[model samples]
Target: MCEQHRTDSALERHGAERSGQPRSCKPAEARRAVERAVTERCRATHTHCDPEALGDALLVASELTTNAILHGGGVTDFRVEVVAAGVRVSVSDRSDRLPVARDPADLRRRQRVGGHGWPIVCRLARDVRVSELPTGGKCITAVVALD
Candidate 1:
């Protein structure tokens, strides 16, 4: 696993407070770690983002990480960043398959136990992106606004 620590620096400026690591994690563990990372990033940045926003950010992070762990085979990398607008969480995994959200209407039609991740993520995040990593896997990024 690849572990990384990032801070505000001139040469390697990320324009935000951020930290990331590439590692394998189970669904439950990933959720806990994402929540912890969000807390740490907020404290480190000295930014008291809206409490509700923070909670939603943590939830979004957990959902994304869980999806990566369960659907993408394994979580290859995870990142949390405090940006001007809000917090951005990115999850990378071994699978190249992109995530799809079920139609909201269809979801009500079927009383299933699962498959609600991407839809919830889209609702909570200000912006969401999925891109193909050059090395074969895919990465999903979601941004939650502070306001």
Candidate 2:
């Protein structure tokens, strides 16, 4: 129901590109980009974008950008686009370490705190990818279904 991002030029297209250090690219900014794209781009082409799906897309963007800043040493680059399949959000960060998904209940069945972002992204997005950048870092791309 979603398409994976095909090229790296998307960050350039959105004009939210950053590298090494985050210039305060907050989660709200990324959500706004997704909202704008889904509203303008889909409306321009007369394509249908499901509201629920848009919400999922925005959450994915938030989780990615937030994770970048909190864990990956800030957001290096950000991109959002409304494709035919759905909305695509890509976030680049300064860490090459892949995001690890921890079970909510560990071996002792103890409930964890504040580690739900990765799981939320995985559940909401139809396509998720992690690619190491050539300049040192990693980019995570997620696509949410519009229908």
Candidate 3:
């Protein structure tokens, strides 16, 4: 169970750790990972993939990874998998701050700046959790239902 998953990006991320290179901080890479995992799972189970659900999951993935990079001091780690409930996305980063959603409308009823990501994630994901890592920093996990 401790065996490392060896996808090309996984290899790259693992290699980066050994060489003191930064882990993947790109949201694009995270989305790709989620896509591959969910799509492959659907194929394996002979399940019809839900396009809207997949899109929501990908958007959630993108929001989480982007938040980790923009606010959590880059992505320390990431994982995506298919579970009975849905597609799960997890992202870790070197920050203790939990994600917060700013009010949609601020003083004078004007929109806020750059605070929509967290809310979008919450709306799309069926479940969201943030945990403190023993090694420091934090991990955020979100489950988006496929059906």
Candidate 4:
């Protein structure tokens, strides 16, 4: 099994790791790695996640990683874990700026075209959360349901 698969198995069995948890990689490369990891993990665990949902997972991961690099200062690390209910993706960056959802009206009116990534992620993800990383950064996590 690949390292990603091992990490997923560990997470499913033990919840989050105690330390040195998230696997680190470059933001661009990590996005694709996370998508594949999530897909394989879901398949191995007998969860049914369609291509669309998997695509959404990939897109959200890309957006979050992009945000971390562009606005959140840079990517510190990220984790992709398979849970009993769904898969969770967390990306940590060196900024504390909380991600915000853009107004739907603005999105529809094309008043703002650039800041819709977080809102789109919120809409596609089953659950979204943000927390302060102890190592001087912020972590944004999104859960994508297997159902």
- Number of the top-ranking candidate, with lDDT as the measure: 3
lDDT score of model 2?
0.80
**Which order, best to worst by TM-score?**
3, 2, 4, 1
RMSD per candidate (Å) reads 4.1, 5.6, 5.7, 4.2
Model 2 per-residue lDDT at 129 = 95
Q: Candidate 1 lDDT, tens digit per residue, 1-147? A: 222323333115555433454457555554455455556666766766467887787778778878887889878887665556566678889898989975555545856677888888999999999999999889999988877
How many clashes does each candidate structure show, in the order listed?
Answer: 0, 1, 0, 0
CA lDDT of each prediction against the hidden true structure: 0.71, 0.80, 0.80, 0.72
Error of 3 at 67 (Å): 0.5
- Tens digit per residue, CA lDDT, model 3, 42-102: 7767889999999999899899988998999988887776778898788889999989989
CA-RMSD of model 1:
4.1
Superposed model 4: Cα runs more than 4 Å off: 1-8, 11-27, 46-49, 103-110
- The digit string of per-residue lDDT tens for model 4 on 67-130 reads 8887888777777766655667878889988988657556357565587888888888999999
List TM-score per model, in order: 0.74, 0.81, 0.83, 0.75
- The superposed Cα distance between candidate 4 and the true structure at residue 133, in angstroms, equals 1.8
lDDT score for candidate 3 against the true structure: 0.80
In TM-score terms, candidate 1 sits at: 0.74
**In TM-score terms, which candidate is top?**
3
